[model samples]
Target: MAARLPPGNQRHDGEYEDLLSLWSDLESALSVVLSAPLRVQDFPAKVRQVDRWLQDLVAHDIDAALYLMFQLASTSSVGYSASHALVCGTLCHIMAQELQLPPRERDSLVRAALTMNIAMTALQDVLAGQREKPTAAQQDAIRNHPQESQALLERLFITDNLWLDVVGQHHASISDRVPLASQEPHDRLTRILGTIDRYAAMISPRKSRAGRSATDSVRAIVGHEVDQRDEVSYTLVRSVGLCPPGTFVRLDNGDTAIVLRRGEKANQPLVASLLDRAGAHHARPGIYQTGMTNKPRIQSALARSAVAVALNHRTMVRLGVYAAAPHNSGLMGLVTVPGAL
Candidate 1:
């Protein structure tokens, strides 16, 4: 049965719609190799299945696309680099779609996403047990996988070297001096995709300090040359609720919401109400727009339990008082924010 979201969930419609689409596509693609051994030789064929899905994303609501992509890539499990590429590519497509870029640019974003994590599969096996502690080199390798993915893509035959080159240099800081050995062509859309591709990976939940809020993530991205920071920033901000993506937050108005939707216009995100401190849903699954409350709004996107336990975190720092633990784990499915947040 198609999973139905309860009413009162502000983002339930949009998020759930996107999720259903993504699940249908992912299931169809992964099913081909579900029984096959997990190996690189079989990756291309499997990825080809995902190609139709990427092509389908060409016209989707970009915000939903990005949110869905982030959900797929930034999980604790399924840390394979290949998975990263798929997710990242999906994100790039969302960015392109949002900007209404040309077909070539959209295609480039998909190609780049598919290749960015080429090296990740090699290291994905290592991620299984290192959820808590990772070695310096492991972390470094993970960070540099873009380059590693490029090299691997070089060995594999691809019609366009442009994507591999972009994937290789995707992580290259705008200030990096080494003339990247890249010659693949690109248009404005392609460049934007490349930029978003890198940004998505950077601000992902586990990639950095888990506490980094979406706003900070946007500021960090502004350092790069991507245009219209306001749009991307707001999209990320509004997509998730008062709680930033990856971080858990409780709102005032006596409600506990998770950051699942980003808005390019406001400060608050489209939050999905999970529980109240007393363990009830005072508010429905919807957006809690965080505005200039005449109080100190807890803006930090920190780990939930840690902050709650260590600091004795109370209910909605900005609103009134309503706090609880997260419950619903279903994909937000890229639901739209109901202007309220």
Candidate 2:
């Protein structure tokens, strides 16, 4: 059953609707650029336009951007390459700000991320839907795609050496023990992009397997078992939280909730419960701000495959906006602010 949002939540705000529309448009625009760069008249200009669009989207409201990105990545109707590029590019943009990367370096890093897999675009889409392991030839192609992508960009008249070099070495391995600040500019960006690339891929699903839960994915990247957290991994966790919005969590009280926003604290995200302890759908999902006093805390992250709720994401996003609104009275006993908790 589709759980209805509560009465006041039924309506959408114009700004929220605009944000959704903007994201949808950006997705389409990016798909065009990534899928057919040769066909684009002014390729570099087009890339910049898309990058500016992404920056604006992220700057407008990062939580909304993450909510939409994770939701698309989990259940993408588009090709895997495009979806993956968007996720990587978005993360790069966010990381740039968090890492305080200089303007030129950030530009090169993000552009490289968006174009890194261009050489394998079709193959990537095919691989996502193929249950079987990659063939030997496909493996070879994947191994060679980074350099090929760089060469292709050069042919397309991209004269940015930093951008080209970053794409070429995006898959290069640097010692994890090395400090990011000590590396050359290109190497630092490469390390940052490489870490974001892996993290993005792990959370996205494919026919071959279900994607890991966000927490598990982060744990893998952060190397929690070995207790060696790289700067990129630490920054990622600090910026996006262990479970960002658009992911799911199991609560201590036995309800399954979808994350709506990053709370004042990372672990205490604002979530809306779709299923009760009995595993039945609720008529109206209950909103809970977890980690307040610790009663209804999150027990663990849930993989998108683990929960089968079909969400009305716009409505969910609206609930988040309302929760953050300055003048909103608490709805259905909802706490308006995490601080209030």
Give the number of the best model, judged by lDDT.
2
Query: Could you tell me the lDDT of residue 228 within candidate 2?
Result: 33
Backbone clash pairs for candidate 2 read: none
Query: Residue-wise lDDT of candidate 1 within 1-341, one digit each (tens)?
Result: 11334445446355434554665466345433322324446565555557666656534434344444544444433444444556556655555555565676556557666656556654654564345567888889888887876776666655556666677766554422222123234433334455555555554445323423444445576653323334543343343332443344555644455554443334455444545556544323443534534532334443343322211011111111111114544333222232222
Candidate 2 yields a Cα-based lDDT of 0.84
- After superposition, the stretches of candidate 1 with alpha carbons farther than 4 Å from their true spots are 1-48, 55-75, 80-83, 124-148, 175-198, 202-211, 223-249, 259-269, 277-341
Regions more than 4 Å wrong, model 2: 1-12, 225-229, 330-341
Candidate 1, lDDT over the whole model: 0.47
What lDDT would each prediction earn against the true structure?
0.47, 0.84
